[model samples]
Target: MSSDELTGASEKKGFSTRKAFIFAAIGSAVGLGNIWRFPYVAYEGGGGAFVIPYLVALLFAGIPLLFLDYAMGHRYRGSAPLAFRRVSRYGEWFGWWQVLITVVIGIYYPAIIAWAIRYTGFSIDKAWGDDPEKFLFGSFLQAAKTPGPTFDVVPGVLVPMIIVWTITLGVLAMGVQGGIGRTAVIFIPVLVIAFGALVVVALTLPGATTGLNALFTPEWGALGDPSVWVSAFGQIFFSLSVGFGIMITYASYVGRKTDLTGSGSVVAFSNSGFELFAGIGVFAVLGFLATNTGQPVGEVVADGIGLAFVAFPAILNEAPAGVLLGLLFFGSLVVAGLTSLISVVEVGISAIRDKTGVGRVAGTMILGLPMAVVSCVLLGTTGGVFVLDTMDNFINSFGILFVAALSMLALAWVWKRLPGLAEHVNAHSSIKLLGWWRWLVALVVPAVLLVMLVLELRKNLAEPYEGYPAELLGVFGWGIVIAIPFLAMLLSLLPWQRGVDLEDPGSDQLDHADRTDEGSLR
Candidate 1:
């Protein structure tokens, strides 16, 4: 039985078409990272030359993992946990690991969205006035002087967080097609237009060419650096929303007989394209800021929060027609973030629906309301800046990379499911494959992830992460990541509800581990 069958068959939900699935997947992929992360990562990695390693990672690591996820969720014809259960009873914990990672992300992800929503309004009035860093850290966030937990709610952050959750969970309650699919179809194009217009406006600024040159100038030596390659892979993996449960859950909604590989290819390219476009727009604005202020592009370039919140506001304060630029830029962030947040929340909701055999709306409320409340309580306080920063770093480094690598290694070697998955993809996909994909998933991807993991651990060990207090890092950083898998395991031990599907969806009802000898791994 499916989630559909677990309830009434007639009440089951999915994207109405492959096109809808593609849009939803793209919406998931083209997110805040594309807007704020890619530019600086690209410029730092090797400027124009970063494209080579990025493309290599995309073809080798990014798209391959995406197809691996599609095969798991679509072929097993279930939610991440349900599908992995079909793979092998032992494999269910891995799915829960992925789902829990999303739960962790879902808790804090909307706070950033809330910030963006508030900033969109701030754009109209040049709200940050003089010092954006001071304004953001002091006035808007009311950040504590040091890193520690606090419960004093910042009303500014809380209201917008409530608003963000209301819109997000509200859409989710309408079921997959009515809500997720439609929002993607509508929001993605609007995102393109909004950001595209921003790009045009950014390019028209006086120093736009200077920023483009800085971004496109090839530092040939960067290609030789091992870390550059790693950054390329990291950006692709993060920007594509692969490895995490987002792609897997979204792929589960795609209709049968759809060309899964073809869809993956489209999504992969569209995501890359959007980010590159974003890099242009972002760097272009940075260039204007640099030239206008008589600074080098390198001096002006920043990444992540610093780029989005700090530097961008400074540009808006000085740039020509600064108000319009602020609207387009911040509005784009709002639109982009909401789409990705929906998918992050969906992964946990889908798993809950599968576990309890609840209908979509009920399952959404069961999990969604609490997640919203926690987001408000934790991230809408003075200490939120400290906790959110630590959690995001620890989770992205230790949490996501750890689960992705463990799941891939387990599914490929222990469960011996790659051949079956490849067969499933080849059956339904227009793009056929040989055995190399199996080898890539089995060996190469995990190797890259583990290497990245080791590097992160070493760097964190070398110094306290971002100079936060040891106790804070221990609780919110190391402690939470340490807790996730143990929690997932305990959750797995709880029996799935009676009506949820537990049988294999493949043609023959055989344990995937038993199929290891099948035709040389397909």
Candidate 2:
């Protein structure tokens, strides 16, 4: 039976409208990374020089892969797990592993979102002075360095995590249109407008050059290092959320016969544009602050979470309308984090709904409850925080790679047995695939992913940057980073051995079941 039939025909409503899908894509792409990770990577990779590789990666690798994903999802008309299984009978089990990565991301991601929410709330409390950085830095570090109810168990972090998760779960429980899809359309644009305004204001701030110089003045020599390439590839993968199976799940919602190539292109372009602008805005502001305060660039860089927690609060406290600016910056962050978290949760939600007969609400709560527990534990232990960070980075960076590989293999090799595969991919595509595009998918994409996997391994195995930890956790983290996609590919071949019908969506008929009948507790 088709997914429509499996849901007893009630779930056969048309897919998300174009505008809604676009909004969701933007929401997924513009997250904490745009504000936090992009600036740091840009500065570390030699400013302007980093821009070249970033743009190159986006154009050649990111965009094409996005189009590829859209095509695959639209063709199968199912979630990632079912979609891949539809492509090849053997690849059915690989979907859960992809979902697993998203679950790991969801665990730590909310904690960060909670931090943003807490910061935004602090803006309203007026607890911060014109020179809040002093208090912000001291408080956070003191809390990290010291153990007591004052910092570790403080409501500042814990409350926000709970609240953010509550709101996120509530929205998700509402389903796509009432929940995920609708909320995205509203917040994604607001996020962009707020971020754009903050950038404009940040540029005008006094002594902003320190941040700009550190971000834009590229040391060309740095580009030659192999690590730079690896970083670029890693950024491309993570920024697009390519390998995580998230995109595939999202694209599955697109209406049948939608222009996969055009929609994918728009999403990729929008995402890359957000990252680029954010890099310029954030680093420039930080550069200015560093120069004016006479603080070393290295110091600012070392304080990863502290950049948002300490530095930005300090910078805002000094501005003319500092509190308002803080509100905008952190408010946008809250929205961004929420949108990203939605995507992360959806990956697992899709899996549970498919593999079992669980409703979306039950799946989301089942998935989220454990994360809440983990976050609470992380709050209690310093080492737990590092472990969470490592898991997120390793899974996001390498996990997605494996997902992407499995996806490509399914479409290119496994799905070749399907009837009219090319015709299905091109059904609603605006630009017809040329003969060359087929070869590119069959050869080029897989080759690029393989090369990236090797480079990532070499770089991780090489000496850690000065002062960086080289312990067992760190090494294990690196290993996971290298193993995620490779293992994904290996796992993609499993379902076939179990005698599952991987070539048809009917194999997972329950995936399309509506949870509304399960009651709210679901």
Candidate 3:
């Protein structure tokens, strides 16, 4: 074990206060998914009826698993790799897997942010012109005619991407308190305020009720569909940012006395609440678009990059205050996406610092520079969207969900530490988690995730996703999905740094020691 590990003193870099930690955690959870993915997924799953399964998933799988992550990180006081390593020598690889997934996400996610940044400017002049779809795909992106590995870089996209990288690296280099914590404080409130304003304005639009009716008119029959239930669980899992090692890494900064359960609940519900809020605004605007275009809301509703860039811009063009509204919409995306990008890169940053003992500035530059360069170079190309779409599907299914399932299994089954971890959480929190929480984390969450994985795999294998080319799916899609875990396991075989301890029991032991010391004092 390393001297620092032996002394338990090296892991001192943390958020300056509890509030900063909460905001940062919230920033991580409320990302592009909240804005882009949730509403569509909710709509497709069961519309208004989906809320029931979603809430059930949150209580049963999302929050319970979130508690597990916080417990692991707080108890171990380390990034995912160190935290998992402390559990078992082999556990470190899972941590690396999570970190690797973050790296992959980090590569392409910022490119979308770049698009948002450009669109924010375009919103000022309605530069997207009459045909927003043609402008977005042809004029701005110069998107490939087909889904292939073509590399025609667009300067418009590349330049903004450079700016995005510069901002991301700068914030990350400032260390946790000055960089992430400070940024979160500013960005999270701004995001909520801006989005809140947008929602209010959207509700005032002519077809707001029509949009909302489409969103909340629950198809009760959807509740009976197993796919709707699966979709709910998937949305909760991805939306909360649990399985990706973000919560674990973020919680590693907490003090021993920090209230894990209360803070976790706040983070969990805050993310969900924001999703619901965003949905209201999103569907409201879509309703307006449908009314303006004389189309049904279903015909106009879109998701992911399409919803943000293409459909929304087209909708804004028809608005009375198109420029101002467009600016606000895309600006919100830029802010939300940037905050998320910060959290995603931090996973890699934290891992580097732990593994190499590098300071924050160097670690940020090390990973940030390469990630920025590659994102700009690759995603700036004509085929960038194709690659981004393919990679996203594969990673979310195999990379993130896979790691989450492994994490729960490792904690609940391999280490047999689920009950002990629950005790750790209850010991420090105002809200006490019951034994059922253990069963939920141990059995329920993993099983649901496993089934989702199988179904997704079956669907993908059955046919090309989105009708993309087979070669693109083979290389960028299945290729990345297969490579990540293999790389993680290989990396795990390497020796730990000299004096680095893998078995340091974290906050639980320290709490016990404190109580014992207090008894003696009494």
Candidate 4:
């Protein structure tokens, strides 16, 4: 490890504060996935029973693994590769795959963000009444949500996507304090307050009781299904911001005295809190509305486009108050997506910055421009979005599992086992694990990951899905997933006999020398 990192500090100039950390992590964790993805997954997973697996996964898998990432980052105090090197030289090779995944995700995710932005903006003027879906085909998502002769490709989608990307790049290029930290400080709390308000309103709706009961009640049968456990584990891992190298890279920028374990706890819980809260908000509003309309909960739950794009606009048409709430909710989603997207871009940008010594502005554009073009194309074709969808599945199923497994192995076995590993983790922890937690990490987490990997691989082999067409695109999609680790291994072949030299050796001292007491990120 470099002298700066071993000393447990970050470079002061672009370092993050506890509050900044909280907002940034929240910003990273709470995304359309929270508002858009989780509700659907929860309903599909087992309704109220889903919470059981989710919480269990959080206890056994998410929190400990998060601390592992933070510890690795703080322990190494550099980019992802440098952090992995602290564990072992071979491990640094594993880090590159993570970097690659982040790069690909950064390239594709803007399309989703662009879509969300378009939907949000669409709600602003041309009010589509209670059944917005009726008008949507003739209006918004003209190609996908409702397709017909009205589908004429235009610069509308691409223009807004570019604007969003440009704005995000500008903030990132401004450096952490002026850019990332500042935006988080302002936006994260606003998101919490706004979403919290939405939840309160959602609960007051007509069928809220059914929604709340559905969300909170436990169905014991779900506990028996292996898929439930797998879903829960996936949610925790994805929501807690692990496996993306985002947390690792972000933690590298935090100060030494920050209490990584404690901070990690706050981040993990804060992430889960938003998800649980958002689920309640979505299901409650939909449930109440469904009851009034006498629609089945299953149909209501399947109202994917309806809830966000259709029913939400309908709610606003009936009550302008809902329009305001809709704005806040979608606004929060936009912020969350941006935060995660920024982290994704930064991973690749950091790699380029380290190797080429390029300016952040130049690096960002170099990484972003091509990705923006790709996102535009994805938005253009019926099959275009397939690459992104396949990429998401490939990474979530294989890439994340591979990294999580490797990370556990490195920490639990290769790094001299858990007793000492636990000490390193609990070094500055206010909530230290006893002994059982160590055994769990060494045994349980890895086993769970292996089972998940096996199931995913089997599912792919047995139920190979062909989304859209264009075999070349399918190949590109799967290729990126496999390429991540494959390239990482190739990069690891380089000799690093001189220990590891960080891109910022002076970072730790700079971080330590500027220490100040601050509250946790939550």
Candidate 5:
């Protein structure tokens, strides 16, 4: 809560306008998960009826957490670690935990994007041929025999991966407004148009109605299942990218006068709308696949890598004007994935610049080169798929949720900074954050996160994740998830540069709110 942040002043770069910030935020939110993860999670939860809990989760947990991030970043006017560091001495650990989580995500996120890049080209010839599954694992990936580290490079993956890193780092080096903001302005609309066209084409296919029915046909009884509710909440949390440092870092780039609450609402709704749109397109295609193959929709549907690389490619081969369908779908993935990856990688670059007071290029060089090397070395190898799959699962389940809950507790009950944060947001927000908003952010969201964590722990402990070997799970999945926090703590011990102001702002009214019976910011 520096006076500069209070006055809407910035020492670092920022978005030129509110529209850019909104576009940038939406770009981060609408990602690969929207395309592959949400539809399956929705169908599994309760088909169309899953929208009930999903919307509830969005309103109650997702957006609340989103605003919480916004307040912290916009109020403190720094990267995640610097922002939390401004809150109090003990709070920086949570910030670093988020930063480290982004690091892990950045390491592997681009490989998926690269896959989409190559596949977009592969669509032209139906290069995967009849056996898409085998081609994915055995041919394109050259997947290793076992899930462990391997230096053996796969040219198909490596080349595209290098290109992905180049494109991402290039954009990041151009500064916030010129690179991130402008790219979102340019690309988000393109993504919408391309994916929208794909949906239209998908609807025109035979059995599209059957697919729509299978997708939208709600199981009324699923609402009674606690697991379905958990699925809905999980989908909302992950889909919004709320808990992680992404929103926090992104929000810091926004102008202080911006209507953060309004922007947040816009980003949240746009993300969910895209997800639902994606579900429609995916199911329509799946229905066509079922009709063509003489199988049920259930058998044709999949999630994660299987949905994009295997099922879609198989579906593409049999459809009329198959090349256009493949291009639209896979090309959409590339667009969606690039925007998300840039956001992910930007978290690290911004953190570096804030700590060292480096130029954008210097920060990009420091973070980008090493990140790209590791991304190419580890993720571009034959064993990359195993690492990507395991890391993506554990990190999303544990890394993000774990830190999010802790952050809420630390801000609400520990430091007692929620009032000040709320005040900061309310000052500029078009939609006021009231007492209920505080309660939702401080208590309800944390409780939901804890429940999700417990359920995830129970399920993972019951069986090896995806039935991968124990050692692989231990090293890649559990090991990485567990290691991030401890590593974050170690990083927090390092000193900030002279340029970083660690001082707290004047009187945050730490106890005045409770004493005066002020439960919310006006």
Candidate 6:
């Protein structure tokens, strides 16, 4: 019997419309990474030349894998755990591994959002004042004197973190369509508009063209470097938000008739488009900073937290209407971060709901509240920034990439589901997946990911990441990475709760039943 039949058809939940799914999916894809990470990677990789490899990776690896994720979830009509369980009992463990990585992400992700919130207020008066780096590390984060573990909580960070949790949990409590969907509909448009305005303002700045030129100037020689191609692939993989369970979970809620290929393309391109837009705004501001400071753009340009908090704030200190510009920039971060946070939290929420048959409220409270508490307590501390940075590195490098590569291997080789999934995607999607696409997903994507995994592992084994103490990196970084898959396997051994089945819930039967029910209503 289908999960709908087993749990009662009335209980299944989904987005109210196709647009809701698209908006929410795009919201998940566009996050702080787009705003901060991509521009620097593009600049460093090969300037304008990076776009060549980025587009290639997107076509060969990113979109194909995205299609696989969407088809799996939409076909099974369940989140990652349940969706993979429908494939095979062992496959369920992989899904749980993804969930655990997302859980780790959930714990610290909000803390950064909380930082963005505090910075938003600071933007009002250029409060970071003079030495922006000192203000961020010393005044705001109150970063630990040493890299070793410490529990000193920064009140400035904790207070906003509470508010962040309250808002996220409240929205999630409203159920998928009413809460997540509605928020996406409202926030995405505002995010786009807000950033659009920032771009307009940025272009009018004196150094805008200089920044644009720096961004787009192609260094033809850089293309030949294998590392540059690897960087491009890595950027696309991370930027697209694949290999994590977010796409799979979001796709699970999509309507049966939704076009998987078309939707995946929209989400992928929308994410890339935003990255390009953000790069323009970011580099434009950087150009102004370099011009004013009598430094080159390369010296002023940075990425990750440094770019968002340090470099940008320093520029704002010198810009006209600096305070107003600050608000728009930080406000954009909060909106982008919140949307991604919702999706990350939803991965765990949907997994719990699938496993135990709990409603949204119960699931959100059970998982969300604890995560919020942990986020507040741990990230609230002085050493919190160090810890957050460590966790993020390990999770992305080992956690996400490992799960993604494993997933492709399982679907293509073990289950042999790729051909069928391609058929499912092509049935509804305007863009059809042909024979070669299967080889790309099966061979090309996994090979590239494996290379990335091996290279990262070799690097980490050689030395502690970023020169942090080995003990700290071992516990928070490598420890968590190693633990996820083992824990997932352990969890898989537990007997599934009653009403959840181990067998595939036949899609044909579910579709027929839905049609019959609709006919009766007519």
- Clashing residue pairs in candidate 1, if any? none
Of 3 and 4, which scores higher on lDDT?
3
Question: Candidate 1, residues 321-404: lDDT per residue as tens digits?
Answer: 788999999999999999999998999888887777677788789989999888888999999988999999999998999989
Candidate 4 residues 380-469, lDDT tens each? Answer: 444334455666777778888878787777767777545644565566678786776777677888888888999988877665545333
lDDT: which candidate is best? Answer: 1
User: Each candidate: how many clashes?
Assistant: 0, 13, 4, 2, 0, 3
Candidate 4 regions exceeding 4 Å error are 1-11, 125-139, 142-153, 303-307, 310-322, 356-359, 380-383, 415-421, 470-473, 491-522
For every model shown, what is its TM-score relative to the native structure? Answer: 0.95, 0.81, 0.94, 0.85, 0.94, 0.95
lDDT of 3: 0.84
Candidate 3 regions with alpha-carbon error over 4 angstroms:
1-12, 506-522
Whole-model lDDT values for every prediction: 0.86, 0.66, 0.84, 0.68, 0.85, 0.85
Clashes of 5: 0
Of candidate 6, the 10-residue stretch with the lowest lDDT total is: 513-522
lDDT of 5 by residue, 230-335 (tens): 9888988988888778898887776556788999999999999999999999999999999998998999989988999999999998899689989999999999
What does the lDDT come to for candidate 1?
A: 0.86
Q: Model 5, residue 46: displacement in angstroms?
A: 1.3
Better of 2 and 4 by lDDT: 4
lDDT for each residue of candidate 6 in 34-126, tens digit (9 for 90 to 100): 999999998998789999998998888889888888988777767788779888877999889999998999999998999899898999878
Q: For model 2, what is the alpha-carbon lDDT of residue 255?
A: 51
Runs of candidate 5 with Cα error greater than 4 angstroms are 1-12, 506-522
